[model samples]
Target chain A: MEEDPVELVVPEPIPEPTPSAPPEEVEKEEQPAQPTPPAEPTTAAPPQHPFLDRKDFYIPPASRLPEGSELALAKAFLMTQSEKSNLNLYDHLTEVIVRILETRPGNVVDAFETLSADIKRSHFVVDRPNAPGAFQKASEVAPANEIGAAQVKLFEKSGLEEPGDPEAFGEIPDIMDLSNLWEWAGVSLGKEETFMLFLSLKSLVTSKPLQSVRLWGKILGAKANYLIIEGELKEGAVDEDAPQVEEEVQENAEEKKEAEEDEDVPKRKEKPVIPLPREERVGVNKYVYYVCNYAGGPWTRLPDVIPEKLQASRRIRKFFTGDLNHKIVSYPPFNDTEAQYLRCQIARISAATVVSPSGYYTFDQEDENEDEENPQPQNIIINPEFESLSPEQLIDPANWVHHVPYILPQGRVTWENPLGQKGEEEANEDEDEEEGSDAGEGEEERENVEPETGPGILSPLSSDEGP
Target chain B: MSFINLDDLPYLTLVGFTLNTEEKAAIQSSLQVKKEQEKLEEIWLWGKILGVQRDYFIAQATKDNLFSRKFYYSIDLVNWLQLPDVPSSDMDRISQVHGRFTGDPAFEYSLGEEPEEGAEEKTINEEKRLSGTVALINYETEIVPRGAYYRDTLHQLQKNVNFSGIPKGELSQLTHYLHFREGFDINKRTLQERADAFDESIDIFETIANDEPKGVWSCQTERTGSVAILRSLLWPGYVFFHTANPPKWGSMYYGTGQRNLNIGFML
Candidate 1:
């Protein structure tokens, strides 16, 4: 019974409520209960300490955060929030954040305010005259002028001119007119491609002040095709002592050596050699060529075509690989890569094929009898007295003639380079040595002199009429 | 011979075989004169074959039979001299001479004697070889869109006047193109392979899809999917173009006349 009382005392705080309890016993119980309450608090203190140590609002460290958490947060925020009536508040906030991040201004709050204000100022506003629920015409709600203004702003931001603006093209030839002209000749780049090319060409013209620009024909490559554009530079646009002149001298020397060596070979039968006509800088090299892989691709200007490269290109047939730097491995090794080859071929094709209606152009008759050593430069002018040929007369082959002189095997209009008098003297010495080796070839000597006296205009015609 | 439009030559310039205005005019007039002089049932400009010295312009003409078309070549566009017939026996000999044409009809290629002992040395001239090669190329790679021609009841192959054209969607597939040549043996095909209802009138030729050493023909859609261009890998520079709408088709061979021997390895 005594053990039971001790057990009751040990197990129960309820014993304090019993009246049978002594005053000293009650006091002892109170003391222990107070300490027990304190003990409970002591036991819970560690967990409470962790909670107390946590920040008021928590953010996971970058390492602990889930992948694409920002995107998830944004998606959740967008889903929960209703759009503002007149503005995309979410987009505005995002743009503000981006600007703040990019610029990282010292006073972020101030920067944010300024950026938001600037964006609001520039934002395209739609004039809403009708009440909230009122029916409105489509054109009234979105006027063409406002749309065009927005488009112009977008084009300006992209650093491109609006294609529809006539002034954007500046001096570039009108594509519609060019297409119509080419259609008469039975040539077309297709409707969509022509428009695309025109837009690209307009951008090209905007970059520089060109006197004239024309779409040259495409050259197909093994991998891709080249869309060529020919443009004439304004006078004084290029330097007089350009790198091309130095290249021409070196090329001529190599060509001269090759010609001399070719004469010595016994097995090969050579074609009748004609002296290249004098290099008319105003004639051939006047037009600058730019090529691009596609209609909208960036254009690259090709180097000036030296006569040596042109002559070498004539003897070989190769397919381009669309890479401008591709080396041509041929029997008579090409000196340069595909870019120069392309330029040379362009020069050759244009000279051989491009033509105009008879009497469309007239030669400067005043310079007709200029000194052979130093022929005065003459420009062919548009004939004011030109008369359109009837369809009947136009159908005849004899009625049409090539306007450009034939690019000879030596790759020039005249046999000797008038600019390089020293080179000409060396060529004479080599020719004398070649003649000495082929002793007493009087017939060959006469043939060599024939081209110097022959009329240049009639040469291309006679050659076309073959044996 | 097919009817070729001279206007289409300008489109061919996109592939690098451009004819100048003078050449175009000459060809137009010369073809008309030759058509009258030869009394050709149909005639067309074939293509240009590049040579070391000069280019040979080819013209094809058909008389009584479409299969037996005659070929004429000219160095100077004014004259169109017919190429002589090449015997089948000399074809193997001609194939041995694979060098580029010298532009001279009289140039002879001495194809060294056959491997067998006591065999005489063989030789073939440029003209005969040219004819043989043209025939070989025609046999192997010449193709027409399905239904362009139909075999008549009397077994005569005639151009189908009512043939609208192969559909634009079907143009890019090789199965829609057929080798326009004789000797398509239907009996050789398995019963399962011939399960489709084959119309004898139009399905008399072999489909180019079934050609051995597959991928021999490269088919592409151009001009905003309005025109289909097919190029032969075996003969590198042979190109054929066809348009579905308005129904126009033509082929041009502008090459060195050398077979692309690397085609096997490339494939």
Candidate 2:
């Protein structure tokens, strides 16, 4: 998929000033307009500062380049201007965003491009937080500040700031490290798209522990920030036995009570055992979790805060596993969701297993219980052309190169540490010295120091470590 | 190895047991009777105990006696009743020895049920079956909780469990520990007794029995294709004591996790 370039705001078309009188009058007006600005500057100009002459007041024609180099110059000048003022960088960016959104909604792609561009611009100067904020969302929205004073104040009060920008390095960052607390560029999507994105992330983390991730995106048509998170992949933490959702728990308890009250007619879907996705496929002790902080819909509150600003809020409403949120994520038959689940399983198995050229089907076609007359699933798939290949050709390593991504080779991580080796060598030297002393005198000396009598005839216990 | 070596006689005395002259003769005669009547085979006197009215003697024999075979006898010194295979009695003796070693005083000759104290007549059917028929020692064994030596045992069990020079008298401790650590429940009463009372066969031991805990366990099935024990230790603190037979892994059909949830003694 090709990504769209950051869009520049198309300025409103300027209206043409009507021509007053005729072309002669327009020339006279133009002459006065040019001469009067010079005459006024000449009358007010100080003779001591010749560099400030009327002619010098005019902007150079170099600024009028059509390629929009003027805009970059103007931006640089404004940045210098803001450095003198109390305006903060982030507040300035937020004000820019509010003004853009204030415009009539046009192309979605263009809007996203503009939004990301403004974000990247602000991200360059955004302040780093001194401490991690409390897990909660900011409820109040402050007035937008053209000079980012208010945003700065909010950050100062909350003791939190947006994630650091990677563009500061002048290069695109690598894919977010799954082992670290990674932050992705926020996006606004429909509820369905959000669910799909969640599924994709879950698939990625299934093979490796996604320690932490913060994805700040808006759910379309919702006024509140909708946050869905697969919680921390902590080891040995079994999810709570019962469903963590309060409503589900209540429904289950009520159904149980009613079942006790009545005997014969079983209520369908009452206390319906919500099956967790991939729970059966995964290990019983596997601890994969998730959380949906806010499930926003049409009836959700219209919070004054914007999504980007809301991301600054440290409020984590709940902690849960992927199994808990599986209730909301619909896994339909033969869909991308299912395919992703299968892919994750395959990736995990591939990581743990080694594929070999000597490997073949553990069971033969004849061993399968499927009817011979009926269409067999294995038969439906075409087998690789192995018959024409020689035995040596069959075991060729080139044929197995595609599996490289699945298994990480040991050599890649087995870098030798000189410091560690030195420590080991020193310890070994100490052990060798201890063994030498324990050998009693020396090998030649021990032969000469042998007991004078034959075996079993000893002088008994001696006052020494070795008796 | 023979059930008891001559060197172990002093250890038996330390445990408050001593064999008299007549009791020793009776045990020797009983072994002779078993050898003659049961088509002749090598035998070893494993344990000898003097009871109130009769002397209880245990003799182990094998066609070869080289490999670990589960064949033993419980004989009465008075009648010379040569009972071939001690059924629940074998498990009882093992349970007592393991209990003493592990400091579990609650261990007894039965499950939770108290054993009948008074003398009881041995059934003719029990005697006949013991003389030649297969003696199945099926009992629930307690799994040691994941504490102390759990990590150590788990690491060691991952390698081969070799009980090569381990004494037969002390085999109970090692066997019970291995079985328990591998998530099998152990007790004095046989699984058959529990099954009979419950009206269903609740033997999960068969599923995991094949996995010789390191290699300490003696496999009854000599040489068929062996199945690997499903490793349920997904995380350090997490524990899954129950496992399925035929090893459930990468299968389409789902089994209930509740059944796999352990309901047994910890430690």
Candidate 3:
């Protein structure tokens, strides 16, 4: 079975109720604190404050969020550059990538328990005093990025009888050195891919091999903000414990003064956009793994194993111990071993069917109900062929990606039976007289209600914080 | 401070035609109410002149400036039949370039005033143009905000604020319109008292503290970047401006455009 991604859409949020008095208002009066409605519980567990998750795969201050967290992060990261390079790459890729994370009818998921890395950076700076601007200044030195196809593990000569130690497969290469590989693109400013519909990588989800220390070591040493994992390497999967070395740096490159904001101009023009790591997989014949994605985030000195940074920054420790989400999906082994896994997959989901109120689609059903209910029902189907299915056999709602609303003459409109009313259109005069109403009332009243048209108006009313 | 760009000002001038009665209406057919409405319609046909955005709109002058209580006529509702428009279809062509010819007999003849109704006839050699046309209100605008200028002070006075808490039944007819309190309370408040209070507060916020430039200096070749806020004419429905086009030809020219126009209906 494919590692199908599922999406759920709640109604648009209404404005939260204002507290009895706003915090600014609270500054004035000495009144007793008035109890107010509490906020809704966030999806992340209570113990995990969304802002502290420090898993190794860190989305830099400027990278586009995982497909799920895109919008929330869009407003959040409006002022930060995700890459280390001073080159203005964020501008080139941000909007396009957002268009890519376009899975229809889904809300942003809280993949990182913590607020984005940029917010933490601000809170780190403004929230403290005595500290020098060194941390902020240090971030200004542009980061280098690398993007290459994924190396998926195809088939390890199955360990028949007794297998050789799974450990001695190959020597772990130094990650930072750009010279050890078949290919590499250093300081790649942004990353992007064209998502083909119905083609997605799911092997990343099923092969959760975190048990190995070598893979962890390799990730620990990688010097890229966004690491793109490809399909080929995934076939020959590396154990998680692969030991890797950080790339040597060319010292003496100077750091530029970061942007100092002023009163009038918008600070947005100053920030850079980050590109997330992309994995590429192709031509998986007889593949065992279905599909999966791993966005190799920014290069970070992982404090999980080396906790010096963790000791100094509770924020960092919290990310590793409490917030990183390790996703895993599994399936029964199939006869075609290699066909089981897929990597570097991309898919395009369109919102074309989302009609007026938003985005459109419709359901088509059999005509068995022609003599039944007042306004007949139209069945929603999976494919456009409109093959009639039993009411119970409609396309599974889970896969019915509602990128937009249902629209078109695709839905059935009831026709007035021609045999029943020859003069139905002009029956108003006769009907009123037949109903025994007064003379002046015969004409339609000023309020002639129209049949609903166009897109249904989604309520713009903000969600009330409380009753 | 950010520089003001030309694109910010909505328009160079606002030509609001305030109907002497209702701004919006629902068609009703009661003969008695219709009769009263007819009288209003007739009166409004040649209504009394109120005022303009300020003296800024007046192309020419009146006998009074300092002694004139013209501010009371902030937003003037004029009777279209009373005051003649520039009369010629060539106003767009008559801008300042050849405006010097404005004083010629031909110009006076075009105005149908060669006989010099309120003005004296010049001797054959006398300058065809009157000695000079003065502005109604001369504003000393600068980079800093002139409070009254931004408030659209002249337009504010024309607002009818004399309502005595609106009659109980008229609640359904309309809601209170202005945000700030108006001095007058309609018939209940003494007119003299309302007038005094209004006059007292009129010049309070006259100086602009954050003075962003306003108006279009456009003559076709060099265009203002933001069209929405060209000149001081406000874009419909937009009340606030966050951007402006840079000044091109000049910094701030206290010109004829800010002159006051007579509103109210002119019979």
lDDT of 3 at A75: 28
Off by over 4 Å in 1: A1-186, A238-281, A365-370, A374-378, A417-467, B1-137, B143-229, B233-267
Better of 1 and 3 by lDDT: 1
User: What digit string (tens of lDDT, one per residue) describes model 3 on residues A346-456?
Assistant: 110011222121112343455354443224343333444434444453333322234222121111122222112333543344345444443223333212322222222
Tens digit of lDDT per residue, candidate 1, span B1-267? 233478876445445455656678999999889999988877788877888888888889987778889999989999999989998888988888878899998888998766467765678989998888888888888888888899788988888998877665456788888888999877777777777736668887899898877777776555434567777878877878887676778787878888877555444
TM, every model: 0.46, 0.17, 0.15
lDDT of 1: 0.65
By descending TM-score, how would the candidates be arranged?
Answer: 1, 2, 3
- Of 1 and 3, the candidate ahead on DockQ is 1
Candidate 3 off by > 4 Å: A1-467, B1-10, B13-267
| Candidate 2 residue lDDT tens string, B41-154 | 666654432222332344556553233344443534533344444456553433332111111212222333444678443222323322222222112221221111222322
Count of clashes, each model: 7, 26, 140
Chain A accuracy as TM-score for every candidate: 0.52, 0.21, 0.16
- Among all candidates shown, the one with the greatest lDDT: 1
Docking class of 2: incorrect
- Write the residue-wise lDDT of candidate 1 on A204-282 in tens digits: 7767556668887787565456889988766555433233545565666579657767776641145423233434344
Name model 2 segments beyond 4 Å from true: A1-232, A236-253, A256-467, B1-267
